[model samples]
Target: MLTINNLSVHYGGIHALKGINLEVPQNKIVTLIGANGAGKSSTLKSIMGLAKASGGSIKFNGEDIVNKPTTNMVSKGLVLVPEGRRVFSNLTVEENLFLGAYLRKNKEEITKDLNWVYELFPRLKERVWQKAGTLSGGEQQMLAVGRALMSKPKLLMMDEPSLGLAPLIVKDIFGIIKEIHRNGMTILLIEQNAKAALEVADYGYVLETGSITLEGPGKELMVNDEVQKAYLGEHK
Candidate 1:
């Protein structure tokens, strides 16, 4: 469970996010969808402490984590699979996955999680010894998500997981997302593909110019007139 209230972020004089309020309940997928420069990624970065928040509160469970260090956030079971699938290019798939569990000392549990991740991503299992950079874009994205899962996150925050992949691969990725949620992982997803994101999300929010403009059930928002016209590319 996560809560963000009155969240604001600024870069020099440029206001990036303004008083954004949102929540991710336990075992649910909450999506934030918007066009470029809408501050969707900034919200996730602020929660992970990657972006400095000028003011506001980011609370995971019950504690305030507005300005907490990124490492601290990871330890608290909050993890981010950033946009662009920033994988360690030179590292082998196995090595990349092991790095995700860097904070944990329990070898047995880490091994178990490694197996689980492999199961979740069979392609990574096949390419266990291959360099991450050599993998296809879809494989690299899978590696990114698999690496994040290795950390055993409580609330997984993913930014644009479907970016740049083929349509079929995007569909596969979203399917995996739904499976992840079905397995009881709470997700805060920021996606540019509104149709795909809303289809998998339980609740969805529309962010515009650094603020929340619409919030509703994912299905409801999917059929909304404005959402249809703007994000879904449908005209009434």
Candidate 2:
């Protein structure tokens, strides 16, 4: 659903991306796995126009969306759940969730999507009226994902959803990712947790520094010697 071709980015003198090429096909989960500062987040940011693209094109569906306004992403059926769960601390949980659908005027559909989000995350439902800052980290992450879903996007891009969380909660988050994929949500996932990300991805890319080093079927990449040695923490 999204295609990035020869995309590059620069922040002053630092060339953060080196003409990386990637694609997220319809109804498929694609992952970019790399270490910190590997330009994984830059790729997503460029797509969302959060970071400026220094060169090349980003095609959503079929049209080029390289430098479009970030505000238009949702209406085009694209959404991003950023690396940090940036929930509104002062807003109640329900208020934060409703804010996700603020762009839309379909009140009934918004309410329906809100209930679905609550169902997907029962904890958020339980804390519906509570201050967002009071929720645990995992709950905040769920809130972020749930908020993104409120837009009813065709393509969902998530950056580092499992960062700084407990292993069990990470597992739960991956399970939720799988569940969302099973229901046909196209996902472009950026993760440092290669094992979990690749295990869930339909396809995977290994990014190094600022370029794509390897791309393959998710299971194939999982067993690749280079992937194992570097990202998967396996010797030999």
Candidate 3:
């Protein structure tokens, strides 16, 4: 559903991404797992047009999307949950969700999508009128994912959905990610938590220092000697 070719990004003199090629197929979960500073988030930012690409191209549904306005992205079926679950602090949960569907004029369909999001996250349902700023970190993350789903994206790119959460909450988040994929939402996941990301991904890429060093089936990468040693904390 999404294709990236020879993608590169730079910040001043720092090269954040280095000629990385990646793809996300329809109805599948693809993950990029790496350490901090590996440029995983940069890839997502580039796709969203939040970050400029120094070189290469990004395509969505076979059309070149490089350098398009971020506003144009949602209409073209692209959405990002973004890093850090950046929810609107003063907005009610319900209001935050509605903002996601602001571009759509069909009220009935928006309501239906809202109901689906609430069902997917019963916690958000319980806090419908509550302000997002008061929510816990895990709940905020759920709200971020829920808000993105409100856009009805064809491909969802999430940046570190599991970051800084408790282990149980991280597990819950990954479970929901799998459920979303099972429901036929294509996902491009960027995760520093390699084990959780790979466990649920159909395919995985190992990125290091702005370049992808390995790509394989998620399970295969999970067992790769280098992946084991580096990300999974295993030694042979």
Candidate 4:
């Protein structure tokens, strides 16, 4: 569904990403995991065109999207629910959701997506009239994901969907992610929660200091000696 080749990014003198070559197959959940400064988020931002890439290419659905404007990417069905749950503070939950479908021309299609969002997160449904600022962190996270889904993206790129949520809430969110994948939407997930992310991912990449150091099947990554020691926290 997505392919990135020799992707590199720089911020002033800092190399945020170094020649990242990666591929995400159709209709599957692919995750990139690493420590705090491992360029995981930078890769996602590059895909969204939020961050300018110094070099390389990003392709989606067989078309080259490298250097495409973020708005153009949205129009082309690539949406990013960024790291933080950045919902509109003053807007009602329903209003926030409505804005997500702004790119959709059909009212009926927008309404259908709204209904699906509510079904996916009943709490959002219950608080439809409430202001998004009033939602708890976990609830807001769901709202963020719901808002992204409102864009009706074919490939949803989620960055740290479980950043600061409670364990139970993380489980709920991951379950929703799995459900979304089951329903045929592809996902490119960048997460720090390696354990949970790998559990649901079909494939995984281990990124360190702006480069991919390991790549394998998700289950294999879970048990790799170096991966287990550096990422999984295994003593052996």
Q: RMSD to native for every prediction?
A: 0.8, 0.8, 0.8, 0.9
Local error of candidate 1 at 156, Å? 0.4
- Candidate 1, residue 208: lDDT: 99
Each model's lDDT comes to 0.94, 0.93, 0.94, 0.93
Per-residue error for 155 in candidate 3, Å, reads 0.2
Residue range 1-236, candidate 2, lDDT tens digits:
79999999999999989999998999999999999999999999999989999999999989999989998877898899988889899999999898888788899999999988887899999998999999999999999999999988899999999999999999999999999988889999999999999999999999998999999999999999999999888865
lDDT (tens digit, per residue) of candidate 1 on 1-236: 79999999998998999899999999999999999999998999999999999998988889999988999999999999999999999999999999999899999999999988888889999999999999999999999999999899999999999999999999999999988988889999999899999998999999999989999999999999999999988864
Q: TM-score for candidate 4, please give it.
A: 0.98
In order of appearance, the predictions have TM-scores of 0.98, 0.98, 0.98, 0.98
Clashes of each: 0, 0, 0, 0
The 10-residue segment with the lowest total lDDT in model 3:
227-236
lDDT of 3 by residue, 169-200 (tens): 99999999988988999999999899999999
TM-score of 1: 0.98
